[model samples]
Target: MLIHHHKTLCVCDFTTLLELSQPKISRHLAQLREHGIVSDSRKGRWVYYSLNNQLPDWCQRVINETYQASQTELAELLNKSLTSESCCE
Candidate 1:
């Protein structure tokens, strides 16, 4: 959901947006990275993650469909995130 909303995100962003622990967010991101569903790059002390642009067309389609199906809920979450104090900032 975060990826669908933001171009890129850090561990702090996930923790703040999802209200999850840093370790839990890191673990999930690591799995996505390992599966080639997401990619990461490090800058100084922070690691940023984004959806892999090279994902197969079918995979991208599935993601798009899923997002569309959950658009309302995801949008509400995004709005909440936007209103909250951003960890990235």
Candidate 2:
């Protein structure tokens, strides 16, 4: 749910999801990417990741529903994905 919310998302965003450290969030992303659950693309120094919508429809449904749940969480989710975390690391 968290991973896909920030489509074209990246590491710094995940950190805040679990209230985790950057390295920790990164590790999680690494794991997900390794499993083909997520994907990445380099934009200069930043790497953006998003759910591979090519996955089964069920998977996409779950992520989309989660993102649609609350406005605040959605805002935070996009912020983390587009920019780095707005606060301290």
Candidate 3:
């Protein structure tokens, strides 16, 4: 969802959207990064994540399909975004 809407998102965004603990989110993100599904960049004290541009076209299509199939999940994320904490300056 983050990749779909914002293209990139800080760790805080995922924690806020999923209502999960930071450590758990970080762990999952680490796994995703390790698998080359996502990539990260550090800015000041925050790390932002986005879909890896190096991923195959088929993989990108799969992501888009998954996102499209997750309408309810995306609605939940949208609701969370309205009141979610942000790491943006």
Candidate maximizing lDDT: 1
CA lDDT for candidate 2: 0.66
- TM-score versus the correct structure, for each prediction: 0.87, 0.61, 0.88
Cα-based lDDT for every prediction: 0.85, 0.66, 0.83
Candidate 2 C-alpha lDDT tens digits along 33-74: 898788888766777788776778887776677767766766
TM-score of predicted structure 3: 0.88
Give candidate 1 regions above 4 Å deviation. 82-89
Model 2 alpha-carbon miss at residue 19, Å: 3.6
Q: Name the regions of candidate 3 deviating beyond 4 angstroms.
A: 82-85
lDDT of candidate 1 at residue 6, scale 0 to 100: 87
For lDDT, candidate 2 versus 3, the one ahead is 3
lDDT of 1 by residue, 46-82 (tens): 8999999999999999988998899888877776564
Per-residue CA lDDT of candidate 3, range 1-89, in tens? 56766798887888777889999999998999999999999999889899899999999898889888998978877786624437554
